[model samples]
Target: MPSPIAINPVSPSHSIFKKMSKSPTNLPASAASYLSAVSQADAHARARSLATTVTPTTTPPLSMSSSVTVFSDDNVLREGEPKMFDNDDGLSYPPIPPTSEQVFTTVHSEFGHCANEEYRFTSQHPPGKPVPHHKELDPPYYILLSTYISYMILICLGHLRDFFGKRLKPSAYTHLLPHNGYAPLNSDFDSFYTRRLKLRIDDCFSTPVTGVPGRTIICYDRETQDYNANLHTTGRRTRGLNISSYNYLGFAQARGGCADAVAEVISRYGVSCCGARLEGGSLDLHQTAERLIAQFVGQEDSIISSMGFATNSTIIPALVGKGCLIISDEFNHASIRFGVRLSGASVRTFKHNSMKSFENLLREVISQGQPKTHRPWKKILVIVEGLYSMEGSIVDLPKVLELKKKYKFFLFVDEAHSIGAMGAHGRGVAEYYGIDPRSIDILMGTFTKSFGAAGGYVAGKKNLMDHIRVRGHSGPYAEAMSPPVLTQVMASMASIMGVAPEPPKSANGTSSNTLIPYPGPAPAHMLPNWFDLPPSLKDGTEGLIRLRRLAFNARYLSRGLKKLGFITYGSDDSPIVPLMLFNPGKMCAFSRMMKQRATPIFTVVVAYPATPLVTSRVRFCLSAAHTKDDVDLILKACDEIGDWLDLKQGVGERWSLQEIMDRAVELVHMDID
Candidate 1:
């Protein structure tokens, strides 16, 4: 393992401190009184000042550096005053109110104490002009002013330090503060998706213990070989894929060809990229992966990045400029919004999946007309996701493409949750609807979910890909996608593209040609063992079929819960089946009870920001991987938990399967229209 890098601590220069100590002009009488009151109220001021003297060898905490000290008037000694208390007695008389000269002198001294060596104070005003009233102040007043001034100076210096340190040389503390505000923060700080995903990390690592009769306790022993725990401890798990991950194909944990490919990468490149892509990055493996993605998606070129978030953030800004306009779906992923903001383009958001709203916005843009400004033609980009992560609803690509043709706007589709889960062969929503992949100016997807690796890729025309390579902000500054992992992603893509086998013949006398192979493993006992390809080549065909079955299972489960007198939201066609539990405290209790019964479930308790205070829910994601039996088991568990709570009945109305399917079809039509 490579040794960890050491970071140098920032130390305040003597000159900087000296400048900070310099006195400021007199504050208003009111402000002075307020400062005095504040000083009197803070009991720890003296102790804090004393604590500053004890400097540790390690870097000081930011809070410690920002802490303010309040000095008493007795601390100041004048040259010719009668000492009310002797120095020998360890007591001193309060010094006289500072004169203008004394104030200036004290300020100058404080300034000197706080400033860096490089900082020099030069007065803008002439020195002989009785230093304006604002220029000199009493010691007590000056002290209060100096504290705030010092704080501002420190903040500026910290920014300067970060700027120079990152732009000039490699530093151990480069991660402390960003050199530019736009630069990506540590991944953990920005993503709500990540927060939701972490809920299941503990489950994956849990182990069943032996010799515990009627009690299956989760083991945390080292011998259990909890891979997730090991990965987290060693910082090997760079990407997140928890309960919220849309592993439509169950590739994440399945012991198949995909896992084999991932293992091969681990054997070759170890775990991490170790450095950003621009510097000693861009390995052959990455290039191969990009090629595979481009071919699979029917795109001329592709550029892989660290994550889907970056792919959107980096690409949008690179394609659209100041004169351009971006027409985005209001419900698009947060990453797309951030990217559009960075583009410096005028943005207009259409109602979520509403074609009419999108057309209206486009018409308005068209009416604005070409200006005689620097850019002659007004450019427009339409942004939407192939599938909404939260809603599990597919985008109406054909309708969107028609609008794109009419408006002459570029179409960017984020296929993060759709790729490998839609289309005739799982090519994504565009292909699922039989829409030419070429119609999508840019299509982005992630490898962390269905592909069982970590990274993202943007597929588009050759020119766009070339432009991004040269001009994309994130390409040069941000770290490149990991190479080793790309190999696994590519391998998985190839496997998904491989010919699917035919489903086994049914035991019934009737023979059906519609049944397709299971694609992967399936139990022999499960009826309708064959997976049927959708009849139409339209976009979301595969997704529609899988979604339909998942929805059916969801509705079946919801109906079961309702039969047991529990309330649940969504119909058969909806991928997300939410069980309404009004109280958060009760929701948590219900979750515990479900776990005790060994039926794992997901819950999203309504809190201030996530949802309105009145509506809390136990959200269930219906995956293609989930068998009918799995859905039935979940329903059984819900009943147990609901009965325990005794408030299961009258929670909410249950949605019908037919009603949900009809609603989904309506939503799809709305997007197209």
Candidate 2:
């Protein structure tokens, strides 16, 4: 038998590949040569075949392959030449990065580990409705249109328009990916949708939502197979009780301060500033908005950006560079992961929300030092979220602050899903824990979810804001937050602050207030001295009433789901209610049944990439607008669906609130002394 081939484990800095950079002629005749199109597993099979083919002859010298070789047509582009290739192949290949020197590839150890479908997001499609195709005039439609115009000749001195919709709505096949797996050199394209229609998915995820995403709103039943795609829904004009939208505090309502501000700003600024923040896109409204958000969140200053995803992905690089370490929760959003990668900082992940894993990982990294170098890290940032959007779990802010104090590390928090929807004062995790917000070094959140606005904000000390303002990648390149969006956000903040004065009762043909104050000086801190209500806001009115109603609805939903024997994820205090179905097939069934029920329950069915493979879920966001009866209705329908599918496993054995609290407390104290 051939002697066992030995290859040392390689680091990114110096791989086993360097040793294989030998001439092709120098390799023994028995050496293996595999095609680049094949996966590492296939390559391994070929290697084994080659190993047995030689019958234990002297080992052949390994030779690296050249990626810069000529094409099949003998075409070769010189350096700096524009890329030219043929489309006749009809295959999309990973670009072979050109290099003069030979580049040897290695096999991955965990090649088939990703047999599960949760690895779907590695490809572009992920798990959702397909992106609509661009518009084009159909030839048949154009012919029919011309005939009508020519036959009648009743031209009304107006430009002709295409009545027929041209945007091709993708079917179920578009949502699927080819050759999905974990880390691998390549994939095997085995599964595909054949000409015969297999199982049909409704593909109505983008079914247009009209008016407010309140307790009840008008929704076009795209589930109707023959429904056409348009700005307005023509199918049945059905009203769905919405639990899917992330209008947590119910600020997205049409007759609110948020909507009013949007209208006023649109009339004044014409929608957009049409430039980057530095290029006059930012107005005084933007500055005022930032300052108000900072004060409300208890930060010295803050910076606002047009895109929420960019806030994390861009600011992280500005904060940390090489030689720094970023310890992040495994469940942190993809934006945070991308940010850490882009920052060039060494990243380590602990178990999701496990304080024990966190401290252990922190201890290990601090004791062992940086990878390869064993040198001390220049700075370390421990990043976490106030509330995980997927799991709906809350982070123990006090415990995290304690750990930060013990380790002397900076704490960066993403409150995107929590800020306006959490705490007694709607501040976030810090207030939820009754801990000072000042303990956190970097606070980032988005105005999109709870505030019903279209941007994100990063709040911290003045110096931190200044550093990001000058060095951050997000603001200089991307367009500034739209003026209307900024106004809406500012108005929302004031509503939370309770100084969004009640609009005068006037019969000016407007049910909603058109004019709103741009928010006055921070208004007093909401929880100053605890239970001390701000004078302007009565003890039980304005923002307080909304907060109370939302809290009650959250608890009602949580208890109801529990009673149904359906497993739910998230803290009792959180408005993000994720019902864990685990089975992907079940998730699809639950989603369809919920919508097609006697009373349609609109919800978000998240599978694979969003949650883990088996834990695919249908998440319901609570709103102040949801009544007790609404919660009961959802619980009843979900119970019926779960029972009909025989999904109840351990309803009677659900963990108690006290048990959860005790366990959390125990974990926090495990390594304290």
RMSD of each: 30.6, 31.2
* Model 2 C-alpha lDDT per residue in residues 386-480, reported as the tens digit of each score: 88988878886667888888999999999998887776777777766666788899999998887877779899999989999989998789777
Residue lDDT tens for model 1, 1-673: 3212111111122211111232323221232353343344333333446444332121111111121123334333232333121111111111122322122111110011111111111101122332111111112333335434644664576557555765677563444446556554654234322233222233322333221110011112221134122322221111100122355544443233444556666655667765423323576566656666777787878988887688888888988888788888887888899999888988889876767787887777677654555344367888898766554455766678888777787888988877776544567766556567887889899886656677788999998898899998767887765545665576556555542334467799444444122222112122112212122211222223433333344445544555455555433223455566655445546654543332223333333234333344566654544444344456556655666765454433454434433343232222110
Which TM-score value belongs to model 1?
A: 0.51
- Model 2, position 171, has a per-residue lDDT of 39
Off by over 4 Å in 2: 1-204, 223-234, 274-281, 500-521, 524-540, 651-673
Q: What lDDT score is found at residue 265 in candidate 1?
A: 62
Tell me model 1's lDDT, rounded to 2 decimals: 0.49
Q: Enumerate clash totals for all models, in the order shown.
A: 38, 1
